[model samples]
Target: MDEADWLAARFEEQRPHLRAVAYRMLGSQAEADDAVQNSWLRLSGADTADVDNLAGWLTTVVARECLKMLRTRRSRREEPIGDTTAEPSAGDHDVNDPEAEALLADSVGPALMVVLDNLAPAERIAFVLHDIFAVPFDEIAAILERSPAATRQLASRARRRVQGATPPRQVDITRQRQVVQAFLTALREGDFDGLLAVLDPDVLLRDGSAELTPGAAGLLRGARAVGAHALAFSRAARFVQPALVNGAVGLAIVPRGRLIGALGLTFRHDKIVVIEMIADPERLRHVGLAAVGP
Candidate 1:
């Protein structure tokens, strides 16, 4: 194969990684694709015969483009942080864009992406490179034009900001049934703080009910985010009754004794970690509903 073909192949391999980095940096599908495309354009024109680290080179290129986009948005006062944009679809790349795929298995959650969007451009780049991509701080220092110590500070600040936005680092599912019960009670009462207290720090709540939108959204994470969601839909909790799901404690959506939905929760150290809320009537028939007296 010729040098051009080899180069194209090499870039394709790195596209997924590049896309993941861009998504975390920009938090917009269209913007991330633009950054990745710009990076390829730059790569095609650059003299890379002597370049040793192609991945690092492309990463640096993409980071610069994302940084420019962030700064421009900030200057124009067009801050689009945490709006209702649909989350990035992991492992799904634009056929033409090629670099829009997210990191597999470990794609950034909707809650975390909201936090990253709030960070400054340089802080976001430093954090993504060093913390997310595992790029060395010394190398990131060069990218951000800061000393190693300052670079570390940027990542540190960004890390702290993210921590504040995310759930607690540990999971406690020992009394998961009790936790789920309390969660339901809290939801019924519209006690947002009480509900958050029982959710895993990074709880993933996926609602695939026939009554609502028909897709798995990357939204609903952390206690606060999940709590807000639960509170918003608290009216539904009033009709939920305890049930046996796969021999574990679960919730059945019963309004006036008519079964409609099933919520089987996964716990970690007394916390609700993963909430599987299924509202499809056909699927509900398989949940083995049994009532618990209030």
Candidate 2:
């Protein structure tokens, strides 16, 4: 084989590893593929005759690409508040391949991805590289162009949020997870009665999204009203999943595998009594998120 063919084969060998890194960094399968492809483009044009660690080189390239994409996404974000449009509207990569998507989901659970989505670009890169992949701090520091100590601090901060430093509310966490899971299942199945079943008779739904009107107009009372309202946008339930929101069980709306909103529900007598819809980007940034299960 020629030099180009030999290099192509080597790159193909590292494709999965590179894609996995990108996925954890970007939290979007489509973007991960793009980052990997971009890395390949760079690799194909570079001279690697003296390179002793091709895999490491490729990982760094893809990570940098992912970091760039993340920064761009943050700066250009313009989605409407409380946006619950759930559909697999991503570009052509592995969209039609459910098995591929499922594999990706298993590698990085929905809950963790939601938390990763809220992390700062540098912090996400640092944490994913150092913590998840076991990359060295010096190497990650090179990627972020910061000192190793600074990079370590970034990873530490991200770790605290991902692991949830604050204790959950004074309630039965196991029961709350079950209740939240049931509510999500009901919402996804479009079972109005199921929604009402888990919601208290006098449940109060408050809209903290910027899209809602102020004062009493943002509040909806009664199980019927809340259930009906949830069903109105039940399509979002398809992407919503149970997650640890602010140290307790809650729902995160991750349409197209990207977290955009979260539902903070308060329970009473094992029934949901208050539902808080938080969609403002700033508010979401401050909300602590952790994985609900292993």
Candidate 3:
């Protein structure tokens, strides 16, 4: 009815898009919410009487906040990464609620989030806006304070890495689930050969690359080594269940219905070629594993 009420209503309308932008930029639900809140604080304090496009203005504000947050997160590289899960631990948002579930699922997937985390703050801003949300390069450039050409380049680099991390493949979801289930069943039964049977002879198990702990293994070549590691971690398999990882059927390690981590499997010729396990608490918490679980 009044000026303040009209402004509040306008902000509420763009809140979803703002949160989505912040979530993709920051990769944490809490941080995303914080970024959105920060944007509102800025808008409330600033004079937006002359601002023609409130939507674009708010997006830029939220993006700037997210960029600052990303830089802060990167500075504390030495700090132990806390466990992040699809289920926002804040408890303010109920996972059982469909609206809450939609927000949780918006962060691509846990595995992709980890890769996106590796990108520099600006590159992430560029990629997430242009690649994920289809924001124009010129608008993103203004937010990053870089030339449109530079912003486009940043998005290109980030896109290449994202595409590289997740090699494009037409995976059969049903068959992949069966393979994952078979592997898990064998793992529980301690069937080493059975584990090898489901895996490619040249299977790759890439445990850690910038995730939870500094001591995580980089890569394990050959089925035997991969199987041995699988057996070693088999005790945790009881908690694992079939789920989608980056749009493909994989497994989520949910102990007591809490998402601990996710495994992204790459299948070739009906055999597992790559197994990427993300168990770090910080990275795990941001992933939407809880949303796709059994």
Candidate 4:
């Protein structure tokens, strides 16, 4: 086959893998698609007389492109669509058996993503590539520009955080329902004291949309501030209903059944610590009402 035909064949085979990597790096399907397209353009135009390991070469090109996009985005002060509050219902899945459905549900559970989100960018990349996709550390190190030893360290730290972090214990559908129902009741009733009772003393509340202020906005630490924030939201906005977001307790808000926002809550030791409210309209597309009882 001619060089063009050979390259075309290889690109077709690598597209899905490249897209997956790009999506994880950029955290947006649209950006991942663009990164893959740009990689093809570069590959098509490059001189390939002495190039070896085309897959590695293409991946390197794509990684650099993704990094460039990240840098440009940071320089321009563009924030990601951070509203992560909506919880899609279980009915969205069309599983036939209860056991199979339960397993699938557990696989992509919200708690997993929350732990993943807490990871540093490099650590996340390394862990996802190595653990999720089974990519070798040497390859991941190349993409991350670090020694393989350092890459392993990054993955180890991410693993430790995920393993050590406590997930909510109420796995039964009915029990999860009760906990969230209680939480919503407290919020709706404007019972700040009651809400504080269920919150961890060191709870962290993050308004993803707010500008990052040094000790001002973004991260609100302590139960007092967290409770106050919840009270303020309860007073100002009306939450539609609770839902199971990525397998964690979540709530969706609709001003007029038009899906306005979502909130994903994570619990540790039966006390809420992290509250992520996603108000950006664009990010609400994947979220919907909760299907499970809770």
Candidate 5:
């Protein structure tokens, strides 16, 4: 084969890994695909006869492209974050497909995606490369144009935000997670008894979404009433995942990679006493949401 054909083959081989890296950095499949395509363009034009690791070189190129896109996105923050813009759909390939986006969201995890969106461009790049992909700090330092120590600090800061420090509060968080997980599991499985187990006898559920149930309206009182409503809308459980709502364990309703709503839970004596559904676009954009786990 000719040199061009040889390079094309190599580029095709690295496309998957490169796309994965870009997706983590940008949190959008279409943007990630664009970044990877731009990287291929750079590779086709550059002379890499002396380059020992082609994968590393291509990764750096993709990273730079994603960083530019992120900076541009930050500058163009005209609309609110969770205003429910339609996802782009074109060809049959995974990049623009809604089903593919849902699968990717499930794999990388909705909570992580939500948290990564809140990170700064440099912090996101540093944390994803060093912590998630296992890239060296020195290499990441070069990407950020900072010293190795500084790059490490960037990742450290992101790490603390993502994983959180294990203090006394952590114990409470673990207990909360257990209750939330059980609540989710029961709701999804349609286990009425299980739902009652995690719910307090006098549980209160307040839903802010416009489409409130007929009689229930905005507020639901008592465990039996709340459990019944949960079963009625249990289909939404498929899109829900555990997340940190204002520094406590809760649920994030992410569908097709877009965070439409969140369930902020308040617990008392190992039971969920209050479940507030925040679906108002204004509240979703401003609420403090993050990944709940490492």
Candidate 6:
């Protein structure tokens, strides 16, 4: 076969892995696709005579492209507006689906991804490549432009943070739905005490457009706060529908049935600890709900 045919075969074999790596690094499917396409373009034009490990070379190229995209993305800035308080319109109901919910409810389980978000870009890249994908430190060092020891140190720090962190406890979908229903009921009825019964003692409440309130000084510590936060939102929210978020049971709140906001819940020991509410439009697009079915 000619070099062109040989290269095409090689690219096909490595495409899936390359896409996976890019997706994890960039945290956006669209961006990952772009990075992978760029890698293929570069490979198709390069001299293949001296290429020893095609797979490794392709991965390196993709990683470098992802890093470049990150740099370019960082250079652009846009002001953020926090106006998620408005009620959702009728379009919100159209995005609900049983099948999509089931799929997302199963595949997007929380683990390293959550903790990875907290790390700096370089640290995250180092940890993901070395720990998650088992890429060699030498390759990671080359990608990050740091010494191998430094890359090791970065991975070490990231590992410590992940190890020390608490894993989210699992919550059954039926029970979660019940909790949301009860919380909403109390809110509609103007019964704060009823709402308090359904929440964990260390519950967290966050408005989609505002910064989250820490656990130190909040209403209804634990369960009580959980109930109170639900109540607060229910009072103004037009509809609270349960949906799957990153493979977890979550709620999408719509005021007047429009697509306004969503909340991702992480349960630990049957208590909700991580409640991530996305009211930012840019972040919402990543949640994959814009095209969901009714």
What is the C-alpha local distance difference test score of each model?
A: 0.71, 0.74, 0.74, 0.66, 0.76, 0.63
Per-model tally of clashing residue pairs? 11, 0, 10, 9, 0, 18
**Per-prediction TM-score to the true structure, in the order listed:** 0.52, 0.50, 0.53, 0.55, 0.49, 0.50
Which lDDT tens digits does candidate 3 get at residues 210-244? 43234544767789988987898778789988887
Return the clash pairs for model 3, or none.
82-281, 82-282, 83-281, 83-282, 84-281, 84-284, 84-285, 84-286, 85-285, 85-286
- The alpha-carbon lDDT assigned to residue 88 of candidate 5 equals 18
Residue pairs with clashing backbones, model 2: none
Candidate 4 structure lDDT: 0.66
How would you encode candidate 2's per-residue C-alpha lDDT over 166-221 as one tens digit per residue? Answer: 32234566898889888888888899999988999988787855333346667888
| Cα misplacement distance, residue 237 of candidate 2 (Å) | 22
Using lDDT as the measure, name the better of candidate 4 and candidate 5.
5
On lDDT, who's better, 1 or 2? 2
Q: Give the total clashing residue pairs for model 5.
A: 0
Q: Which stretches of candidate 4 lie over 4 Å from their true place?
A: 1-127, 136-138, 144-173, 210-215, 236-238, 286-289
lDDT of 4 by residue, 78-145 (tens): 63332221123333333465532442344434445456656667777777677655678998788889
* Cα lDDT for residue 4, candidate 1: 85
* Candidate 3 stretches greater than 4 Å from native: 78-107, 167-294
TM-score of 1: 0.52
Model 5 residue 255 lDDT score: 91
The alpha-carbon lDDT assigned to residue 96 of candidate 4 equals: 64
For model 2, the local distance difference test gives 0.74
Q: Residue 228, candidate 6: how far off, in angstroms?
A: 30
Please provide, for model 6 over 98-187, each residue's C-alpha lDDT reduced to its tens digit, 9 standing for 90 to 100.
422332232223444455556667777887677757899999999999999999999999889878877544346566556666655677
